[model samples]
Target: MPNSTTPSSSQALEAVLARVDAGLDASLERLYALLRIRSISTDPAYAPECQRAADWLVGELSGLGFAAQARPTPGHPVVVAHGPDQAGPHVLFYAHYDVQPVDPLELWHSDPFEPQLRTDANGRQIIVARGASDDKGQMLTFIEACRAFKAATGGLPLKISLMLEGEEESGGVNLPPFMQANRDELAQADIALVCDTDMWDRQTPSITTMLRGLVADEIEITAAARDLHSGMFGNAARNPNQVLAEIIASLRAPDGSVTLPGFYDDVAELSPELKAQWQGLGFDEKQFLADAGLSLPAGEQGRSVLEMLWSRPTCEINGMIGGYTGEGFKTVIPAKASAKISFRLVSGMDPDKIRAAFRKHVEALVPSDCSVRFIPHGGSPAITVPADGDYLRKALSGLSAEWGKPAVITGSGGSIPVAGDFKRILGLDTLLIGFAHVDDQIHSPNEKYDLDSFHRGIRSWVHVLASLAE
Candidate 1:
């Protein structure tokens, strides 16, 4: 068993914390250099930029005395770095180097690649760039923490393995195969740390213990062979648009329950204890909705917004197109209509089963004259780490000390596929801790990470590493 008591001297820990504070300017400069890479993995034109980012990380980690290399996958490369060999528990830290593409570039205040530090309306200093808050800024936090530890103690507190992927914002297509191929090297760690999630709020730290899985599908319905004028085909023709709309509309009942048969068979209910803990967090549903220009919560009825988002499964249509949707009106009944849909899965739900059930439901809804086609995008299972493990307790204590408030054990509605892969392929459990805020606007224009989050996040990792080293 791993040591449960905190290790390292108080003076040594304080020295590391002070070093982190003193190195903030250098850390920010390094982050700025990385942010300028334009490592957008989804676009083929930026492939070289992704490689550059991976190479940069390798150099940086090597400079810190890590045995680092940029290993190539079928897609973008992954950077693997090992810290000083130590005797205690080993930890594998994971973060991504790739960022979402910056579209609608007109909305950005500055070039997404040329990172800028600006003060928001609240006088909070923010680093603005495409990947500032999503993963770059968060990744740097752990690296900076390791740097501070090396500077203060002459080595890392514990054995550390760093895995930085370059294909997270885009689907992580190659990570699974890479993990399977290198399972022995990666799975030797006692625990894993993932730094790609959000804090509960600006002032409150959080550890995400649950992540919803995902299943994405694209559906196309075909009727007439070609587009037809609505006036000419009036009541005689079947409109694929109308049929697709009806199918989408039928997905949810009046109380917001999904209409797919056997959809709820595998969904597990939240334990009363867990529900009580969430209730104690003072989550303001109204404020959460109002921030997004909404009033009432829109999920399953009789459930709180937090429960609906974190625990329950959901089906949503991400995009739909059937008829003429240009600036001007064209009264035409299109030959085909299509919709992109995704399902947020909870634990115990099978992605394959959900896909089959959904296809059956859509087939039943399709008219005899129209045919439906289903194209699967991707699927991943939900991941839940034990909330009461020694490593988790250590993280909570360390984070609580750093933030001066207890860290909330929270659940993420979003999916982090690698976390599940770590469990399945590596036999490791991950602790999801990050410093990004809800208002960070990740994957959106004007994405930003608070200067405070960057600085304190480093210090927080220092604490966590020291505590885990015990």
Candidate 2:
């Protein structure tokens, strides 16, 4: 057993936070070094780069006095490390070392692999790179905090375990199996810490209390044996393009409601208390739409934009392909048309049920002598952490003290599958905290992480760890 004494001295925390502030430059250098590696997990061509990233982390953690190793998975490797044990809560910190592929390279002002320090329109100093804000910078915040703690106090305040995966940017096919196989070793933690979410705004910190689920499907409609000339068979032929369009059009009603039968059967309404709390966030829907080059809110008629994004279920046609349009205009009706569709699910919604309903709706629209095929993709259920738990209160208090404002407990419009998996497989509740802002532009060109966020994030973790230890 490790020492059970908790470090309750406010002066100790202050000293650690001061060390973090003083070591900010070295930390940025470390993050820049990691960001330079092209660890794109989706493309098999960069497998070696992914291994290099994992090895780099292993070296850094080992230098921090952690027993760390680069453990190989079927896909990219995972880096696991353990700090010297203390007798407080055993906590697991999770982050990804992989990043999304940067395409449309012309849109970036600088090379995606080169980390650059630039000032944004608002005069905020930011580090621009492909994965600067996504996971690299965010993950480094915790490591820097550990560094500061070790340097200031000579030890970590609690029992700490680190799990950094390299397949998060992809579908993470190897994660569930690995977690299942290593449950005994991995699940001994009291709670999981994740930094893959966004803050409420630029200056306000936030904790992601809920995450929407996802269901993806691809449908192909075949009308004729081959392409038919529009002039020759314009009226006689049933165009699969038109059929696919009509099927997509019929998915939602005029009120912006999904028409699929029982789509909302399992969905539950937000509690009045939760709704009140969301309303208090004072989200500006108009500003949000303006930033995206829009001027109106378009979802269910009555719900607020936040509710539509974070609470309500939605169906979106992600992509569609149909007839020909090469040079001038090919007057041909393609025999086969296809579309990719995805749904954002909330609590109580079953991904399987929603997928089945979508297929039924499409099959009913198929015309005579025409065939349709539904290709399933992936599905995951929504994740909800206990907002009233002791762990949450401790984290909230810690964040509030660091930022000088109460942390907003919010829901993400996006899905983090590992959050749900941690709960389902390891029976561990994950506390999702991050310093990324809405304008961070993650997974897009010109992605950046604010310098203030990088600095304050490390300090915030120092406080959170101290609170958890207490």
In order of appearance, the predictions have TM-scores of: 0.94, 0.94
Looking at model 1, the pairs that clash are none
Tens digits of per-residue lDDT, candidate 2, 1-470, equal: 33433446777778898999899999999999999999999999999999999999999999888999988889999898998877778999999999999997999999999999998888889999999999999999999999998888888889899999999999899998889888998899899999988888776888898899999999999999999999999989999999999999999999999999999998888889989999999888898899899998887999999999998999999999988756788999899999999999998888999999999899999998899998888999988887788988999988998999998889889999998889889999889999988788999999999999999999999988888887
For candidate 2, the 10 contiguous residues with the lowest summed lDDT are 1-10
Q: Cα lDDT for residue 246, model 2?
A: 98
Predicted model with the maximum lDDT: 1
